[model samples]
Target: MKKLLTMFFTFLKIGAFTFGGGYAMIPLIEVEVVNKQHWIDKEEFLDIIVISQTFPGALAVNSSIFIGYKIGGVVGALLALAGVVVPSFFIIIIIAYFFLQFRNNLIVDLVFKGISSAVPMLILVAVISLSKSLKKELSTVLMILLTVIAISVLDIHPVLIIILSGIYGAVFLRKKVN
Candidate 1:
């Protein structure tokens, strides 16, 4: 019970404080789960991140479910899911209710602008942090570049790209699972 509560509160703090959605939460989650708590190693955390990104739901929610299940089984997953979702649900509700009243306020606009500006950096930090775990192989680089081109230039569907990439990784770029 105590461990479950700890998981819940940890995720709750992460959800409450992070501003830019799942990508932004990556670093904070990494710090808490991998670096601080030592609940999982970096490699497993990265694998979970990859799996979370591949799935349909919000990355943060998916990550919480995976990590929570790892720690304390089904009950932990529910607690963690609830903890991570509760703060955002309430915050969004409050913001939706009050946004109209202060929509045009200069301070509000400035604050939003500030937050928006920081969001990109948060995402970048996540990218950089995750990239550290990626193998620095030429094939990996080429795959990344090609994927970017396929999505950006050819207007390929991301889902298709993801499926193809998964196939490619499974067939050719297989890693020795530890």
Candidate 2:
């Protein structure tokens, strides 16, 4: 019960203070979950990040659920997810209320422009972080290259790319356990 409360509060703090979404939350989560709380090791935490992206939800939400489950099972997952979402939900509602009022302000416009400029750098950092975490398997590397080329050069749908990659992995990289 105490551990669940701690997990909830920690994730709540993470969700509330973070801005610019999941990428911005990474460094903060690393400090809290890995360095401070010791809930998970660095490599395992990073692995969570990688696996979370393949899921359908936001990265932060998925990460919180996984960490919560790791710490204290299903009830912990519920608590952590509630902690992560509730603050953001209220904050977004508050912001949405005022955004219409300030939409035309020059300062607001400039701030939004500045944020847009930073988005690409944030995405690049996310890529770099994931790349550092990736195991250096030949098939994984080839799939990464193929996915990049397919998206960038061929303009293929990412779903199709992922599907093809999965087929390739199944056909060629299946492990044989004795």
Candidate 3:
């Protein structure tokens, strides 16, 4: 009961302040879940991030659900999901109302631009943190490098890269269970 409540509130706070979506939430989630609460270790958090990205829907929502389930079962998952989504829904509604009112304000426009500029940095922070948490292995490093190149240079869709990476791992990188 207490654990479920903790999960709910923790994700609630995360969902409230985090902007620019899942990548922006990573650092905050890391601080709260790993550093403050010690709910999971750094490596485990990164692993969960990877799994969330490779799986489905929005990463932040998926992460909240995964952690919630890990801690407190189905009820926990529901509570945490509600916590994450409710804030965004209410905030978006409120903002939509105000946006129409202030759509022409120069200051509001400038503030939104400033926030847009910060998004890339937030994503870079998440990438660096996740990479640091990963084991320094040849194959892992090579895969990361290739992924970076593919996204940056080739402009490949991330979903395609993810799918192909999985297929490559299964076919070429799979090891015998002997």
TM-score of each: 0.94, 0.82, 0.91
State which candidate, 2 or 3, has the greater TM-score: 3
TM-score of 2: 0.82
| lDDT of the candidates, in the order given | 0.93, 0.84, 0.88
State residue 33's C-alpha deviation in candidate 3, in Å. Answer: 1.2
Cα lDDT over the full model 1: 0.93
Candidate 2 lDDT, 74-132, residue by residue in tens: 99889989988999999989989998999899998998798878756766766776577
Clash tally for model 1? 0
Candidate that would win on TM-score:
1
lDDT score at residue 114, model 2, on the 0-100 scale: 88
Residue-by-residue lDDT tens digits, candidate 3, 1-178 = 8878888899999999888999999988898889998988998898889899987699889988888887788998899899889899999899998988899999989998999899889888988887787678788889888998999999999999999888887887778322
TM-score of 3: 0.91
Put the candidates in TM-score order, highest first: 1, 3, 2
- For model 2, which pairs clash? none
Ranking by lDDT: 1, 3, 2
lDDT of 2: 0.84
